[model samples]
Target: MKKYILKPGRHQFAPSSPAVHINDTLTDTEAKWYLQRFPHIAKLFIPLPTEGEVSTAKKSKMKSNQTEMEQTSAFAPPSGGKAGQ
Candidate 1:
């Protein structure tokens, strides 16, 4: 299985943010179509390659994941903050 992370409305005021939409593994043709359709958001399901090597598609996926992480971390509370406060 793989995932397609999509922001629901694809707009600045979109109701929600990107999340994994669990999906079947895609064939190359299907992957290409999705890449064109969603551009920067779609990525392989898991197992991002280590830093030593990568394919073109893997590079794109890593970049997308990195961007998502950065956005999330920016507004997240510090480690000592109480969860419900």
Candidate 2:
């Protein structure tokens, strides 16, 4: 089973911060299931790859930039707080 460390939103950009875990063999389908419950919050969790650093770089690039809120819909889910206040 693969282990996935879920860091909080505040520490999203910090690679060595504290984290929680989803220590099961999370298939693509299962990961999506948990993420759908809280997409915004889940977005911050960085899944550690068993492969090279390039994969991790690709993952970070996939994250949307939150500064430009005008580009995002107002009805979007909160980032588990006051929307990055």
User: Top model by TM-score, which number?
Assistant: 1
lDDT of 2: 0.51
TM-score of each: 0.33, 0.25
Q: What stretches of model 2 exceed 4 Å from their correct place?
A: 1-5, 8-21, 47-85
After superposition, candidate 1 runs with Cα above 4 Å error: 1-54, 82-85
Q: Which digits, one per residue and each the tens of the lDDT, describe model 1 over residues 1-85? A: 3333333333211125554233433355654565676665443333345555557668889999999999999878889896557
Q: Tell me how many residue pairs clash in candidate 2.
A: 0
* Model 2 Cα lDDT, one tens digit per residue, 13-74: 22454543343434556555656664654555566555768687766666545534546757
Question: What range of 10 consecutive residues in model 2 has the weakest lDDT sum?
Answer: 6-15
* Residue pairs with clashing backbones, model 1: 2-45
Model 2, residue 2: distance off in Å is 6.7
